[model samples]
Target: MVNLQVCSFNMVGILFLLSLILPTISGDCTCDANTEEKHNSAALHYKLGAIASILLSSVAGVCLPMLGKKIPALRPENDFFFVIKALAAGVILATGFIHILPDSFADLTSPCLNQNPWGNFPFSGFFAMVSAIATLMVDAYATGYYTRLHFNKQANAGELEGGANENDGHVHVHTHAVHGHAHGAVIPTESMTLPELTRHRIIAQVLELGIVFHSVIIGIDMGASQSVSTIRPLVAALSFHQFFEGIGLGGCISQAKFETKSAAIMATFFSLTTPLGAVIGIGISSTYNENSPTSLIVEGTFNGLASGILIYMALVDLLAADFMNPRLQNNFKLQLWVNAALLLGAGCMSLLAKWA
Candidate 1:
């Protein structure tokens, strides 16, 4: 027979394992904030509604602005478009700082991870800084590569002054032409110059990449959650969030003037990402475990990187570009309005953070 001391040690081991696997019966632990309880059915209902609202809002917001071809007021040339861009930039900024960054901090620093290295080192902020630096490197390199592709030595004299009037300038790369060995597919420039159009295209795609990652994570988060109180407020906040993002992306797409197919595909993707993520979360709710250290690490890392990308894009590509534009700067009144619009958008998203 086992001795009393040995039996006691075995029993303690079993209890310790049980504690790790099972939800705390009573305590302040909130790592499993989305665990299903009495509100399972209601939460699922709210989640479905969220899927619909998020899809519709994003689709409408993006499509309406893309209709700039049909509606003069929607075109980028309109002075009011600057205000919209500012508003969207603000939304993107708040999403990075308020909505996502804090969440990363929560996940990485959760009590569940008290024993992990994540608690010892500031992994989230470090990853975020790295992400921002990487984005800048990619942005600069891509622009330079494309710039060289578009300009010839003959046209190099007026490299900045890109136009066919420069003779050999027509020899420059087509937005749809070959760059290196890859599809030199380029943005169709109509009102805006080729360089400007290309920049917008790059910005749109990079921003989309960040959005896609962030969207899927949040979708799973909402899907895995089983709290009606959380899901209910989340729906409205997410809808508005999608709408604002859609508008911003749509404006970029419109400016880029991509092939009709490309534009539609992008719009569809932006609209569906969150809803799909939510569906995935719901499907996995039975098995989803946020308390797992691995899940926390992955989510926190991705959110941190995504927040960095978004913060960089909003500040550098969106707000900084427009704010410093000659037209907005030359007109102080317009600058004021644009600044006000940015504040309004940031304020709205920041306010929504309470519920989201």
Candidate 2:
């Protein structure tokens, strides 16, 4: 209960900080005086429709895996689940490399900014590299810290129970027993240890954070745009974008095996972020200048950071971990299929980038 409360508080704090920071970054700027103002009734209707469609698609995408618990074939132990996860990780990987990275490059290299450090230095790539390293640090430190704590707790528990054991050196071995079977095999508890579970939970949360940051920025841009032509294609593309991204995020959240409330919180949070960002963009549309120096710096920096986080999560946490799994490594056919699925997912997401 205390952990739940602490998590809830942390989430609230993050939301609050985002609320405060985005507005400051998105506020009116004096740098760009010749901004285009093309707001119209048609565009307003499109944006409103976009909000609804994106919301529904996001909700459906994220909920699919959660509801898949009822389907026997969709269970985590099944081969199909691995394929799905591969596709999802591919989507995330493409999102980071193909989609967000380019946007960061464009923003950081824009002509609106001063030509001193921004123009001379490849700030986008630098920031992205730094962000990636930072993410690696966070991933390593968090996993190591939690694993140490979990093992220490187990050690303490074992010591407390040491007095009751007949032999100090005799370790307890848990075995899997079948009700109808005469004999059962001893199975190692390492398959789903507590620390492993904790690691999954951490990955899910961090992945969500990265996705949410990017999603909100996308929403704000879409909401602030007044071009009907631009908004029309984006409405569809972004809907698909949110849907696939949600599937990826939902897959992680599902694997985390969070409690009902925690799962709901994660799903709801993911579902709402883009739409809420769109609403925020709409509210600030009149004053927000995308081409301004301040806006460029803020958006570019955030995009770079988000790109790093997603790339790290997809490559290190998701792809490497799953690809190197004993089951996948042992099965050549499954490996080939997963690789194909990954390419397919990456291709699909990359194609969407042409418009979105």
Candidate 3:
């Protein structure tokens, strides 16, 4: 966890540094003939409305699975939940590969960059590769650290003599029961222990951290824009963006099964980030220049980092976990259906990148 946090913070710092360098590296152009006073007015109004839609969609998406806990079909172990998670994983994967990476390439490769470095090399691919490698390091380190922590907790619990062994540590003992005429073992009491809950909660929180970074950047970009022609279509695209992203986030939050207060806090945070970004954009509109060289570098670098984080989380944490689970592995038909769902979600999100 410490390593992961360090790597993530480093990425954030690199992005911040890049933002600072942009204005110095790039020169501004005269306003386009199409950028009229009337357009600015329309853009402002549309921005305010867009902020509202993003906030609402984010809330609905994140909260849906949390509330669905009451539904038997939507419970974590249920087949329906499995399919939903697979679908969410696909959405996240597409957001990273199709949406964020392409946007980064566009910004980094813009004619605005100096001909020597920006024009000559593929910084987009380089950044993406660095981010991916960094993510792998964090993921490996964090998992090992957490697993050790679990072992330590179990050791501490074992030291206590008959002191609520189940509650005292992260390890839970399972008893396999045999029924008549059954070839394999059949045990019914498969309750999730508190330690398992802790792991899931940790995963959810880390995932949210990654999602929020990109969310705020997207919101800031939307808010700082002055083009209604650009902002108008984005309003609809972003609404769905948040909605699909929310579904991905919501699935993790649901699995964590945080207490009501924690759940509400997480949901609210996800919902407010984009709108908060817009509000910030409105406040700083006078100073913020989206097309400025400085802005592009900053935004592009951050988007690169975010793309890496989301892709890693989606593929490693979300997709691999479910796809490799014994439940999916043992059931061929269910696995086939999940693969289809994954494709469906990825396809839908990829299609949206056309307009967004």
- The 0-to-1 C-alpha lDDT of every candidate, in the order given, reads 0.77, 0.76, 0.70
Total backbone clashes of candidate 3, pairs 3 or more residues apart or in separate chains = 2
**Candidate 1's residue-wise lDDT over 200-259, tens digit each?**
777887787778767877888888788787788889899999899888888877777766
C-alpha RMSD of each candidate structure in angstroms = 12.2, 5.8, 7.5
Q: After superposition, how far is residue 204 of candidate 2 from its true place, in Å?
A: 0.6
Which predicted model would earn the best TM-score? 2
lDDT of 3 by residue, 1-356 (tens): 22334534554464344334433433464232225443668889999999989988988788777767577776778887788778878888998899888888887777666677777887777777787777667656655566566556445546653566555333332211122103221122246554455456556766776776677677777776777777888888888878877877887877765556666777787788778767666655656766666766777876887787788888887898788889999999899889999998899889988777
lDDT per residue for candidate 2 within 298-348, as digits (tens), equals: 789878888988999899988898899999999999999999989988999
Model 1's C-alpha root-mean-square deviation from the true structure amounts to: 12.2
- Clashing residue pair totals per candidate (backbone < 3 A): 4, 0, 2
User: Candidate 2 — number of clashing residue pairs?
Assistant: 0
Candidate 3 pairs with clashing backbones: 22-294, 23-294
For model 1, the local distance difference test gives: 0.77
